[model samples]
Target: MPTHSVLIRDQALVTRLLQQYLHLLKTYPIITKSVTSAVLSALGNLLSQVLESKKKRKDGQSGKEVDVYGPLRFAVYGLVITGPLSHHFYHLLELLFPASAPFSLLKRLLLERLIFAPAFLLLFFAVMNTLEGKTHSDLQDKLKARYWPALKMNWKVWTPFQFININYVPVQYRVLFANLIALFWNAYLTSVRK
Candidate 1:
């Protein structure tokens, strides 16, 4: 009986804490989103490192050790770039194509894929290369090698995801939802980056 009471108290405490956190996130979207993105991107990079290590081991080679700096790089990029950019992009997208009707969702999806996805993917690749100290020629070459394939893959994954996101998720919760999915997306991006 005492244990049951303790469990109940703990559950209630957790619920209250979660509520407070959500309230804070809503009140300060940019800061919260940046922190969330930084954490998730770091985690994603770590996951990628783990997977790569495992693959190397399975291939009968010494596993490559995970480098702390790689994930740190992703965390910084997420904090400074992706978090704020994605938050504002979603807000503007919603304003331009308010999902008031059924087809409006499709419209937003089309606009996002047709316009935003290509442009953002290009910029993301370019910025990542530049930050990694790639010269202009190297950046252009990397983009040529990776951009279209990554964009194609992005369309494959994000098209349906955005359909649900734009139509179903509330405005305030949209970025949070996307950030949750982005854990896996970022992991994939890290692998692709290599």
Candidate 2:
């Protein structure tokens, strides 16, 4: 919002902070990507509130303490799932093609689909089916019953929500988008619960 405009106007300060933040993440992805992303997001929010209060004191602003447990839980998800997966994928891809670098989401997704998705999907399904004691009939039944439902849900629900976020692809919006994704995952898991 205003922060980006402010940063754009005062490029020096924002640029310095952004570089520092990037360095922190690059250096300590295990910790920084998990905690720093959440922390920075929260602090960015708090700062916005503070500024709003200063601008319109009579409008009644608050400086309430946020419960950081939610962010911490999100951090755990980021660390265990997103961070390590990205790191491992980077290393594995580097070995496979030392000269090529992924520059865009399309490139990265294409690379992943070409190199990793098939192998990972096979291993993943094997482990899942084994653990769940899925017979051939059961697996077929699952594909028949669940696959279309999941595809429909992704297209009808998640895609619309994602498109809304995509409309405003600002840096602050990205953090909020991540938070919304976490919210969606929680809601989906709860829906799937028996």
Candidate 3:
């Protein structure tokens, strides 16, 4: 049971934190977004592991040991790949499809759904396969089995989000917005990889 004053204080603190974060974004956009993505990606992997463990327990099966490396790998990928790639991609999109351009929203959405999404998913699979220390043949097999399914799912889940993100969200905050969405997305990705 919290009092009204406590809630007010909490809100104020949150506001201050958000302001500081914005300042950081303005001052150090790439680094801030990268670190944020890394943290969220790690958390997503952890969330997936926790859910899997709970499911196993519910099924009266002994839970497997947590894979410490999984979250580490996700964090690295987010920091090195996703953050920078998204930062550049969104900037490029804005450059290519300025809002005043005819059918800008539709063009952006189509490009993202058709080109970026599939390529990004393929990159994700390749990178994760490499990170997992799988050989080239194994990577090829994974691509054959999982790539199409994941791309289909990605189209289903992300098309609407990308539409909103491209059309509505401010440019500076796009990566952060995507990162927040990727928190859940990463969890699903981790499960799919498993």
Candidate 4:
């Protein structure tokens, strides 16, 4: 990377390095999408703050750069939430459900709605909040008071938010379905809460 060398000399290189890592993880599909999002959140949160990365911050640059805290925090979410949830949903869909045409359709629908969708979003918010330096209480409240309500009231807007959510949900049809769900949830939340 052209920026890699330029970043090395600068003490302010922390943010750009993590940004590279975030982009790299998102570039792959086999990896859990939640993990990628969590890393991006970590980079965003870390970039906003000024903290020396591992060895780089302490000993100046010796051509070896290390992320100190940001990646660690992101990993916490990946391990605890992203990996486990994906596996659980995978088993639920592939193993537990019948694989017939109508049953597959219904099973897929149910897996997403009753199992994966809400769990994914909830973990996403939590990971994002952790990565973005938000407190647990703040994240909890936002989930209850802000995010759900935002989804409900401005479901139209929320649905549109899914267009840019391509990185997280790359299966085009699934992305479309998730967007529609978001729109409905947003509208529903608004009506009930506001």
Best by lDDT: 3
lDDT of 1 by residue, 11-116 (tens): 9999999898798787998988888888988898898899989999999989988889878887887898878988888888778877675678778888889998
Q: Name the weakest run of 10 consecutive residues (lDDT summed) in model 3.
A: 185-194
* Per-candidate local distance difference test: 0.84, 0.46, 0.91, 0.48
Q: Residue-pair clashes per candidate, as listed? A: 0, 0, 0, 3
Cα deviation at 162, candidate 4, in Å, is 12
Better candidate by TM-score, 2 or 3? 3
Superposed by TM-score, candidate 2 places the C-alpha of residue 62 at a distance from the truth, in angstroms, of 26
In candidate 3, stretches whose alpha carbon ends up further than 4 angstroms from where it belongs are none
Which residue pairs clash in candidate 1?
A: none
Relative to the true structure, candidate 3 reaches a TM of 0.96
Q: What TM-score quantifies how close candidate 4 is to the native fold?
A: 0.38
Could you tell me how far off, in angstroms, the CA of residue 3 lies in candidate 2 after the best superposition? Answer: 14
Cα lDDT over the full model 2: 0.46
Q: Residue 169 CA error for candidate 1 (Å)?
A: 0.5
Candidate order, lDDT descending: 3, 1, 4, 2
- Candidate 2 is scored at a TM of 0.37
Q: Which stretches of candidate 4 lie over 4 Å from their true place?
A: 1-72, 124-140, 149-194
Better of 2 and 4 by lDDT: 4
